[model samples]
Target: MTTLAEGKAPVHLWVVGVLSLLWNGFGCYDYLMTELRNEAYMAQVPPQALAIFDAFPVWAIALWAIGVWLSMLGVILLLLRNRQATTAFLIAVVAVLASFFYQATTDLPQAMGGASYWIMPAVIIAVTIGQWMYANRMAAAGVLR
Candidate 1:
C-alpha cells in the first residue's frame, strides 16, 4: 500500500545510513589512534605499515584526518535524514580520493609489506562513493529532508 508520492522513507535508507555510520565510526577511531600514536594499536601494526605511517608528512596527515572526519560527519548527517549529507559525502569522497592517491602514488605503497595494504583504502573509497550516491538518491526521492 506504500506509494512513492507519500514520501515515506524506504527501509534501505535506514540500513545504509546505519551501516555507513558504523563504518565511518571505526574509521574515525582508527585515525584517532594512529594520530595519537597509541602504543598498543601501533604495536599491533606491521612494521612496514608502521614505517609508512611514520613517514607521512604533516600535510599528508592533515589530508588523512580531513578525509576521516568528513566521512564521519557525512554518516551522521545521513542518519539524521538531512539533505546536507549528500554534500558532506561528496566532499568526503573527494578528500578520500586525494588521500588514497597520495598513498598510492607516493612511496607508501611499496613501503607496505604487500598488496593487502591497498585493499582497505580501496574499500573505504568505494563505500564513501556508495554512501554519497545513496544519499543523493534519497534526497531526490524526498526521503531525506
Candidate 2:
C-alpha cells in the first residue's frame, strides 16, 4: 500500500473531496426539499411521483434518509482524512441499495418509467459504490488515518 507523507494529503484527495461534497450536498438538499414539501420544489415534481414517494413504507423512507445523511457524512469524513469514512460509505451503499430495491418494487407512473428513471438510480449506485471503494483504497494506502 502506498503511504502518503505524514499529514499531507495528495491533490487528488482535495479534488475528490470537493466533488463528493457537492454531489452529496445536492442529495441532502433534494431529500430536505422533498421531505419538507417545499412548495416551489414540489411544484416541479410530478404529482404521480409525489404520490409514489408519499406511499413509501416507513422502512424504505428510513433507508433513504440513512443513505442520504450517511453519504454526506462519509464525504465530510473523507475530507477530514478519517479512516472511518470507509465504514460510513459502506453503510451508505447498503442503505442506498435497500432504498433502490424498495423503489424498484413499487409501481411507478409512466412518466417515471423512462430510461432516465432507471439510469439515475444506476448512476447513484455507481457513485455510492465508487465512494466506498475510493475511501477503502485511501484507508488501505494510509492516506486516511
Candidate 3:
C-alpha cells in the first residue's frame, strides 16, 4: 500500500503534490522548449533575451538542467510519498541558487530587461523553498516513507 495509506493523508498532501507536478511540469516544458530552440517559442522571445539563453555557458546550462529536472523529480517523489523528496528538493534549491548566482553576476540580468526581469525567478525561488519545507514537514510527520 502507498505510504499515504498508513494514515489518512492530509488534504494538503494531494493538493500540493498535484500542484507541484503541474508547476514543475511547466518548468520542464520551458526548459525543453528553450533547449530545443523551438522556432515558434524562440520567436516569441525578444532577440536580446534569447541571446542570454543562447549564450549560456556549459556549466550554467548544466546547472539549469539540474534545477529544473531535480525539481520535477521532487514533485514525483512527493506524490509517491517518498522521503527522498526532501533531499531532491534541497538539491534542486541549491542548483537554482547556483544558476541564479551566475545570472545575477552576468550581463543577462540587464539584457533580459533589468529589475523587472527578476520577478519570475523570485517566484520560482519562493515556491521551491516552500516545497522543500513542505517535504521536510511531511517526512517528519511520517506521511512520507
Candidate 3, residue 96: Cα displacement in angstroms equals 0.5
List the candidate 2 regions with Cα displacement exceeding 4 Å: 1-5
Candidate 2 residue-wise lDDT, 12-130, digit = tens: 99999999999999999999999999999999998899899899888998999999999999999999999999999999999999999988888899889887899989999999999
**CA lDDT, candidate 2, residue 94:** 100
TM-score for predicted model 2 compared with the true structure: 0.95
Summarize candidate 3's per-residue lDDT along 55-144 as a digit string, tens digits: 889999999999999999998998888889999999999999899988888866455757788899999999999999999999998998
Please list the C-alpha lDDT of all candidates, in the order they appear: 0.82, 0.92, 0.90
User: TM-scores across all candidates?
Assistant: 0.88, 0.95, 0.93
Give model 1's clash tally.
Answer: 0
How should the candidates be ordered by lDDT, best one leading?
Answer: 2, 3, 1
TM for candidate 1 is 0.88
lDDT (Cα, tens digit) per residue for candidate 1, span 65-128: 8788888888888777788988988888888898888887776545473588778888998998
